[model samples]
Target: MSQLANDSRVQVRKKSKERSKFFWGMVYLAPALILMSVFIFYPVLKTIYYSFYYTNNRGIPVTFAGLDNFINLFTSESFLISMRGTFLYVLYTVPLGVVIALFLAVISSEKIRAIGIFRVIFSSTMGVSVAAGSMMFLFLFHPTIGFLNHIIGLVGISPIHWLTDPKWALISIAATSIWMGIGFNYIILLSGLQNIPEDMYEAAKIDGAGYFTRLFKITIPLVSPTLFFVIIVTVIHSFQSFGQIDILTQGGPAESTNLIVYSIYQNAFIHTKYGLASAQAIILFVIILIITIIQFKVGEKKVHYQ
Candidate 1:
């Protein structure tokens, strides 16, 4: 009877101690949990709820609209045009951005003198804010007084209206995006390149593999994971491009540069179509989620881990 009582008491104390630790652990996490609830969870839930209803300028749902919001979002010509423009922007930025960044990273990874200077030159754009970068590009691409045009004029090429013309506006924005994005990609890929084993390249060279052969068979496979990450992030960034398009083009000259993100901004803030904007926002989320999922699935197969 005495032994049984002692064992039971010890078990009870152990349980109590565990409960105390768990309570304090939750206490420690309370601040982060609160922040996530307030900023992330609550907003997401509210946006999803508002997506199916009619909301006024104040963002309060005024009427139950059912699937009407989503239906209208799909059928809207402006939405379709924005989606096409976003697709073009992605095409113009992601692949080329990755390739350019990788090439710079590879060149910088060499043991040649003054390579760090070149790396700094390439990565310096990372410090520039989107607003500032867009402004700089806008000035450079200005038709008459711009240095870009001045240089081209020296070669006898006619000056072109960059942002004002529909043909050139989207391409010009894409160029700015690539310029801004390369710095980040280059830094990441350079770190990945530095992490690669030098002996692997030496072995390839000993096997009589030339520069291109070693690059394809050895460097590419080893750096693929980093390359894949850069591609994914660049694609996401390309999709979210807004500041430059807004500052430079304002989605104008026939709405040629109006990306989906800018279109969402127009609907929600500019036009006061809150519910419709929420629906579009949800659709945009779904599109990004789907694309990211596809990238992981396909990219996993190609990426070689060492």
Candidate 2:
């Protein structure tokens, strides 16, 4: 009887200690939970709720809209154009940005004097804010006094209307995006390159492997994980791009550059169509989620983790 009581007492004490630890853990987690609940979870739930109703200018849902908002969005020509532009922007920005950054990273990773200076210069754009970069590009794209036009004129080519022409507006913004994105991608790829074991390259050299052969077989496979991460993040950033387009074109030139996010912004703020905007937001969220999931599914096969 005494041993049984002692064992029971010990078990009770262990349970009490677990309960005490759990209580303190909750106490420590309270602030983060509260912040996420208020800022992230609540807003997401509210957006999903608002998406299925007609909202006033104040964003209060006044009537049940069912699937009408989504239906209308699919059938609307402007929304279709915005969708096309968004995908095209994604296609334009992601591959070029990744390739250029990877090339810079590879070249800058060379063991030479002043390589750190080159790295700093390459990644300097990471310090520039989006607003500032957009403004700089805005000046560069200006028709009359722009440096770009001046250079073209020196070559006896006609000065181009970069942001004003429908054909060039999206491409111009895409170029600005690629330039601005290079700093971040370069930094990341450089880090990945530096993380690669030098011994691997030494072994490849001993095998009489040429530079291009070793690069294709070793460097790419080793950096595949980082490359995959950069691609995913760049795609997401491309989809959510807005500030540059807003400053450079304002969805003008016949709405050729009216991306999905900008279209949502116009609906919510400019047109006082909160419900439609929320619906668009939800669609964007779904699209991003689907794309991310697909990337994880398909791209993970190629990611080599060491």
Candidate 3:
């Protein structure tokens, strides 16, 4: 009876210690939880609430609008145009950026002398801020004083109004996005490429495989996981692009470059339609969620391991 009592006392002490640890752990995490609740959770919930109501300029709810906000969003031609432009930007930028980055990464992975210099040159754009890149591109693409026009003029080509012309404004912005995105994708793919087993390539070469065969059969499949991740993130970023458009075009050139994020910002802040902006934001959330889901589903089948 005495031994059993002693064992029970030890077990109780152990359980008490665990409980104490758990309580303190919560205490340590309380600040982060509080911060998230105030900043992230509260804003998300408030945005959802605002989406269902008419709101004043100060964001105070005035009247219940039911599905009116969502309906209006779909019916609004500007919003539809913005959505189409955003999708176009994604379609234009993502694949080109991924392909360029992967190509650079593969080249950088070679055993060439002074390869580090080339790697740095390729990835230096990663450090360029969005505003800086936009400004640089803006100057370069300026029809009159721009270096691009000057260079092309030497080849007997006419000057193109990159930002002012509706035909080229969105495409020009996409080019800028792709240029900035390339560095990031290159870094990720380079890291992935570096991790690939050298033995795999050696074995393939031993089997009399050519360069293209080795690249297609081995390198691409091995680096596919990183490529998949880059594609998803690139799509998301392209969808949410705002800084470059704001700095360069302000969604002008006849609203040709007015992407969804710019539209949301315009509606929320400039137009003082918080409810409508929130509704647009929610729709964007849904679109991103669906795209991400599709990516994951498709990636599971495509992402090759080892």
Instruction: Give the TM-scores of the predictions, in the order they appear.
Output: 0.93, 0.96, 0.93
Off by over 4 Å in 3: 1-21
lDDT of 2 by residue, 152-192 (tens): 99999999999999999999999999999999999999999
Candidate 3 residue-wise lDDT, 1-306, digit = tens: 999999999999999999999999999999999999999999999999999999998878999999899999999899999999889889999888899999999989999999999999999999999999999999999999999999999999999999999999999999999998888999999999999999999999999999999999999999999888899999899889999999999998889999999999999999999999999999999999999999998876989976
How close is each model in CA RMSD to the real structure?
Answer: 2.1, 1.4, 1.9
lDDT score for residue 30 of model 2: 99
Candidate 2: list runs displaced more than 4 Å. 1-3
lDDT of 1 by residue, 223-288 (tens): 999999988999888899999998999998799998889988998899988898888889888999
Candidate 2 C-alpha error for residue 273, in Å: 0.5
* Candidate 2 residue pairs in backbone clash: none
Descending-TM-score candidate ranking: 2, 3, 1
Q: Order of candidates by lDDT, top first?
A: 2, 3, 1
TM-score of 2: 0.96
Best by lDDT: 2
